[model samples]
Target: MKRKSTLSRSTTETEISLSLNLDGSGIAQINTGVGFFDHMLTLFTKHGKFDLTIDAHGDEADNHHAIEDIGILLGKAFYDALGDKAGINRYAFQFTPMDEALCRTCVDISGRSYLVFDVPLTREFIGDFETEMLEEFFIAFTSNSKMTLHVASLYGKNNHHIVEGIFKSLGRTLKDACSIAAGNTEIPSTKGIIE
Candidate 1:
């Protein structure tokens, strides 16, 4: 099956168009006006080996709205594309290092949504992107996608490296979690349904 989704979300605060291909090679075309955020999203796409494209326009002064909305749409797309949870790994984890930073991420495609993010950064802002916005993004993502996600920074001194590691780890973890097991027809959950 083609595991892909295309979505658009619009509000008074932001307008976003996004597409994701879970089974594609690493390729990304992203534009958010916020250069740092775009770079992070690019890293995430490459590490996940997913094809992704995002075009976003929002209140340029405050990026929170666009970022959060993108996360929400991306998560919803994942949910819509997955169709059934059959034969998937369903759970995965990854440890990624970027320079002096070390971060770990764990993901489970549970029907219940929860997020535990503890990746601390030394700086409050990275270019136009506010570090606090990452939490908001993840909260919306997990809630919309109905997945459980946990992120922890084992060690980090630079804000960029820390955040980079977190995003990369999250991408790789999700890629693994969503991968289908060849020829396995059963869902991973014992409850017989994810939701």
Candidate 2:
């Protein structure tokens, strides 16, 4: 069966829609009114090899709401698509490098929400995207998805490279964590259920 989900949410701050497919070939179309943010999400989907589409609009007065809301919607989409999390690897970790930057990310779809981020960008901004919002996005994502995620940037001088490395590593890690193992159609947890 195709593992897919579509989610939508609206508030005074933003309106968003998200669609995701766990088993797909890294195709993504995203628009959040933040160009750099959209680029990062595209890279995420491409690296993860997951099919995703997002449409988001928010009060441009502050990009924070739009970015965070997108994260929440995307996380919800993943949770909805995974259903009971049966027959999945359920854990993944990866260390990736982008030029001078080295980043690592780990994930567990354990029906528990946690985010540990240890990245510090040398620069204050990456284009129009505030460097700080990256944390906000991940925080929103992990909280909504109920997944344990840890991201660390071992070393990086450039903020852009550092952020890119983290996002790509995260995508790859999540992809591995959500993959279905052969001949295993039951939840991988010893509890016989993820929740």
RMSD of 2: 0.9
Residues 1-195 of candidate 2 have per-residue lDDT tens digits of: 679999899999999988999899999999999888998999899999999999999996878899989989988888888999988899999999999999999999999999999998766678888788889999999998999999999998888888888889988998999999787898888899997
Cα lDDT computed for each candidate against the true fold:
0.90, 0.90
Q: What TM-score should be assigned to candidate 1?
A: 0.97
What is the lDDT for 112 in model 2? 96
Over 4 Å off, model 1 = none
TM-score of 2: 0.97
Q: Kindly report which residue pairs in candidate 1 clash with one another.
A: none
Instruction: Estimate, for each residue in 1-195, the C-alpha lDDT of model 1 and write its tens digit.
Output: 888999999888898999999998989999987899999999999999999999999986588888899889989988877778888899999999999989999999998899999977767899889999999999999999999999999998898889999989988998999998889879888889986
